[model samples]
Target: MFHKILIANRGEIALRVLRAAKELGIQTVAVHSTADAEAMHVRLADESVCIGPPPSRDSYLNIHQIVAACEITGADAVHPGYGFLSENAKFADILDAHNITFIGPRADHIRVMGDKIEAKRTAKRLGIPVVPGSDGAVTEDAEAKRIAAEIGYPVIIKASAGGGGRGMKVARNEDDIDVALATARSEAGAAFGDDAVYIEKYLEKPRHIEVQVVGDGDGRAVHLGERDCSLQRRHQKVWEEANSPALNAADRSRIGMTVANAMADLKYAGAGTIEFLYENGEFYFIEMNTRLQVEHPVTEAITGIDLVHEQIRVASGAGLSVEQKDVQFNGHAIECRINAEDPKTFAPSPGTVSHFHTPGGLGVRVDSAVFSGYKIPPYYDSLIGKLIVHGSNRVECMMRLRRALGEFVVDGIKTTLPLFQDLVNSRDIANGDYDIHWLEKYLAKADT
Candidate 1:
């Protein structure tokens, strides 16, 4: 086991990793930017280091400064709690060269899975189902048009190295294809410095389902069930639930085993999510997240597994603690990503939190690092917390989530709490009869 682990991110996820380390009796070093001088994770860590200024490029993303922090603190491992450097293969390789451990997958795995184009190829090669798309990036407009025609109309153009909905454009037919391809390539260049784009058949309506798996880097892995993240806005997941309400017992087992088997073959290390778009009783792979997901709590709630703990254990050369046969899924769980944003406009809300209150009771968990008087800096993501609720079944879980959302309060800044409240009362959300486009349509209708 590592004696000390340095957390390489901030906000709720940083705090989440710190708690997990503390539980395992591992000393922790928290690295922070000047903007996060008073962050909760820094306050609670065994040691803290100020790396740089507020800008992410100068601070959180600065690899040299982070390595220096590790050296100074004698930290042997780094747990990048998502975002920033979490999926950067270069960062992982640098740590490896310095004899410091990265508590995630191998650098090669990250490198391959980080690129959407290569990830799709790898997924298909691994016997995982993937969306029908161009064999690789289409560099010319003629090729793009040809691929779209071959795949039929209503194709989507996506950046080879894109995420968070950026560098993506959909074309309903031939007339829209040229504009979609040009816009997608332009956005891809601006956002990712890569002008490469690919075409894929776009499903009119699909439920976003993802299987969670953890591997020990020794061809041993296990799946912990699946999460339905169909409720999204602008491609960002707003709400997620475990044991997807859209899938039955057979569907769950089939997909879960398939993902686990593939990870085992790949010798994937630590925690990873194989995301898919489910439609017409089939699953099509989208991409793979090489690190822990923001919505992981819901999976943890259902599986009785501590992902962070398992991540640390596996990274330390310890094989998987639980086997495939031993893994069990129980209950239904949901997670609401509470962001500091306007409920209606969804604009970022950054300010001092005057008063704060978290929902409580059986099966309700709030993962947040903010407190009353905490200043939500404008330099970071708007997500302030996650409210996760678990119950014996989906109905009970929805009821519990509704009650918990009502109890959640954060003052002196706008939040999306009201949005979640309205969603909980909606018939579509109540019945889990929503798809990837449902939230956007709902919001649009509300605007009209």
Candidate 2:
């Protein structure tokens, strides 16, 4: 067991890790920037250290400062919450070199999976279904065109290192291929410093489903079912639910076991998620997130498992106590990512929260760090909180989410609350018949 764990992140996730560590009787050290000196995680931590200035590169992403804080605090383990360095292989390696435990997967897993190209190859080699695409990176426009033509028209050009809908372009025909390739490479280069691009046959109206898998570091792993994250805007997930409505029981079981077996074959450790695009009852591997996901609350709600706790345990050389058969999915769970943004325009809304009111009930859970008088820093993501609800069925979960969203009150800043409210009342959303492109199309129609 870890005596003291240093959290190398900030905001809601930092607080989430702190609470989990404390529940396990472990002391926590919160490392924050000067801008977050008065942050909730810092205030609640057993000890707090100001690492650097406000900018992420100066503070949250500074490995040296974080390691220094850990050394000074004598934190034996480090929990990188979700973003920043959570999936940074170099950071994990550095921590290992310093004899500090990184509460996540092995460095190699993160390294391989962090690259989109390599991840797809791994998935395919592991017998997982992958979208048809080029064998490797299509560096030249000519090669990209060749690959796109071979894969048929309507191919998507993606950066080898891109995510969040950045560095991606779709070509519906040969005429669009040249522009798509050139622009994708340029954008990818600007965004990730690597212009390497690849091509994949685009599946229209696919559902974004991901399987959560945990490994015990000894070739043993289990899946905790799937999360449907089809409701997204700007390639960012807006809503997520466990037990994907798109999949039947048999389809869910097959995909879940496939991912679990693949993790075992790779000897993956800690927590990881295998994202896929589902179309016409087929699952195509998209990518693998080598750390906890932003939508993990829905999975935990359905499984009744603490992913943070299991991640720490696995990192400490403890085996996963629960077997595949022992794991059981419960009721349906839904989560709405509450972001400080304009409901219609999706612009960033960062300011002082004048009043904050959280909803309460049996199935509603609000994972947030904001409170009255808290100033939301503009340096980080717009996500301020996650509103999660669970119920015996999807209908009940939807109703509960609607009620909870109505009760959630945040003043002095704009939020996407109204967007979710409208979604909950829509007959299309009520039937859970949405695909990955649904939200963007819905929003587009609203603009007119």
Q: If scored against the real structure, what TM-score would every candidate get? A: 0.99, 0.99
- Measured with C-alpha atoms, the lDDT of residue 250 in candidate 1 is 95
Cα lDDT tens digits, model 1, 309-419, are 999999999777898888788899999999999999999999999999999999999999999999999999999999999999999999998999989989999999999
Worst 10 residues of 2 by lDDT: 139-148
Computed on alpha carbons, the lDDT of every model, listed in order, comes to 0.95, 0.93
lDDT of 1: 0.95
**Ten contiguous residues with the weakest lDDT in model 1:** 318-327
lDDT of 2 at 132: 97
